[model samples]
Target: MHEWVRRGVGTVAVVLAIVSSAFATPQSLPQTILPGVGSTSWEIRNDGGTDGGPFAGVCDGSPAFGFDDATSASGAGDAYDGAWSVWINGNPFVAPGGLVDVTGTTLLAGPVAMSGLNVWLQYFFSTTHQAARILVILQNPSPVAANVTVQVPINFGSDSNTTVGHTSSGDTTVTTADRWVVTSDGGRATRSIPQSFMDQVLPRWSQQVIRRRCSTVLLETVSVRHSTFRCRARAPARSCFLPASAISPVRAIRLQEQ
Candidate 1:
């Protein structure tokens, strides 16, 4: 049943209406809640595309800028859905072992250049570090070096007046290209992307950029193979916040594709 769905978590909210859908009826829905190893959890909606996922935080933290359960929302960290690329048969491979792999084999009925590029996601909770990890398995099931553009729609929302890339306070200044660190706040949550592993995939990967506006920070990674986005929240830890504005209650950081 393709219909309009309006979902919200905390102060972040959105209204969505889909023209086409993969599930013909409510009973056909695959799964709604995805659980982590421990307290980590995710409430997701089935729509072929990574449309709905209400993630509060890694454990007890709140959603970053806001909730990212919009049409094609790739909310990572604490946004819409974590990290996802392509799918097979207009659906995702939802495995409950804390590990998920989805292939992008959906063929849109249209004239497209690179059609049916295989892409999937490996979402799981790291028992060692106690964090949430998403590994986007982007591969061309077809032989030969095929150059295609993939969208791994991982969305994230930060607190008010929060910043991305670089944020400075007092004599301390922190600059990074991987994760999201808010300016300053009482319950500010900071997430850092796996920049150390960039060199491993730079030869095949394309571009990576993180954007934030109003109350959300969206990260998009353009690559060829696979990209891993990791997130962990530390309670009572120093989070991000902006100047003048009161400390935001929450902010989530996610790594995704464009």
Candidate 2:
């Protein structure tokens, strides 16, 4: 399902829709609800503290952005299945034993932690830009290298309904790239990340270390005529082995307008 956020003159509205199956007939449309909140109208579903990662949703208004469910295009069933989760060194980040801590936002989730690895997952929101940010910090105290993989669904519906694209641009100080989704109905989302960390990390590590890990940063976005939504994820510096303890640089995803 998808959640939306709308910012007007002096009001911010959030709406959530849970579509069990995007393909479900109109008669069996997805369930939608307006949750109660204070000035900030966003809520995070913790799934009873099971998955550890929280799924963000609208607590009071309509969906301001659109992100396709991971399984929507692949026909593999619900990718997230209404729950948000993460993996570290190939292990699921959950509660009671996995995620050490977590927090929420008006339109997103934030600060997820896992024990032992000293890795923390944090999120940031930009009301001015209508974006969501994910920061993955890995402080590997162990001698061995740590591998990180983050899998979030990006099902932008069928090709006919949404357009997908990406762009790479930047200078010496910072290298940046963006992936975007645009819905026919005028909704848009974008995700962006800096390439500097990966560039610095690639050369020093052995081929074995480089090949086993995932991208250092990932961002995806979708947009409409005047609005955009972005999701970004960043990791520690690419040169993982050089530092005794490393704090990967920041990666950001943003949702905004054209």
Candidate 3:
């Protein structure tokens, strides 16, 4: 099913205080929200040489960046579809090293070369509705099948959690390498926020996490019999704005590849 997803990357806890013989009792730090372009306009372009081979693309969908749901060239059309190597800035995310494709292995996998990547973060500032969620997508270009896992620390009140598993197995096709997977582990965290808390802070509350950085990563994991391989890419950090942007309410985000 085509699902509309809302997602953001953030840190789990706040370091409110320090303790020393000369210092006072440590105070609890407050939670933070990371900002992202919910559904604002964004795009990316893949580099050369890496063109003919398979690729992947991820994005927060559009009334802005519309997907060709019926077009075969679109990464959104199928698991392995389209060429993706673009940037939200409209410039190529130039490959740091050369593009290396990983093939044939039970013991080896890529550190595949990828560039022109983009990150989208979304947050819901209101307390009245259930519009809070996070989504992540990974684009793989290697001919060899790739496995991936994403990890994040989620903190709600006194609880802390980590991503220990995956939501689904990756999608790989011979013709293309567009993959979308979710966290099967710690994906949801909600606390019973009181009206008193909301009333006190809603008017003055800023959804932005001021002091700490909040971010998430999309990772790749490979199994090599007795040994397993894992690779991860971190998304850029941003502030989570309040009252949410009305311009584009991120319904979905996709990672595109060719």
On lDDT, the leading prediction is 1
Quality of model 2 by C-alpha lDDT: 0.24
lDDT of 1: 0.25
lDDT minimum window of 10 residues, candidate 2 = 236-245
Clash tally for model 1: 30
- The candidate with the higher lDDT, 1 or 2, is 1
At residue 117, candidate 2 shows an lDDT of: 45
Instruction: Indicate the worst ten consecutive residues by lDDT in candidate 3.
Output: 191-200
Which is better, 2 or 3, measured by lDDT?
2
Reference-based lDDT, residue 160, model 1: 39
Candidate 3 local distance difference test against the native: 0.19
- What TM-score would each prediction reach against the true structure? 0.35, 0.35, 0.20
The residue-by-residue lDDT of candidate 3 on 202-236, one tens digit each, is 21111222121222222111000000112211111
lDDT per residue (tens digit) for residues 1-258 in model 2: 342111001101111121111212121112111122111111223332222222242222221111212211112222222322344433443323221222233222222344334433333333332223333333334445544433332222232233223222322221112111122212332322211112222212111121111212222221111111233221110000111012223323221211
Q: How far in Å is the alpha carbon of 103 misplaced in model 1?
A: 17
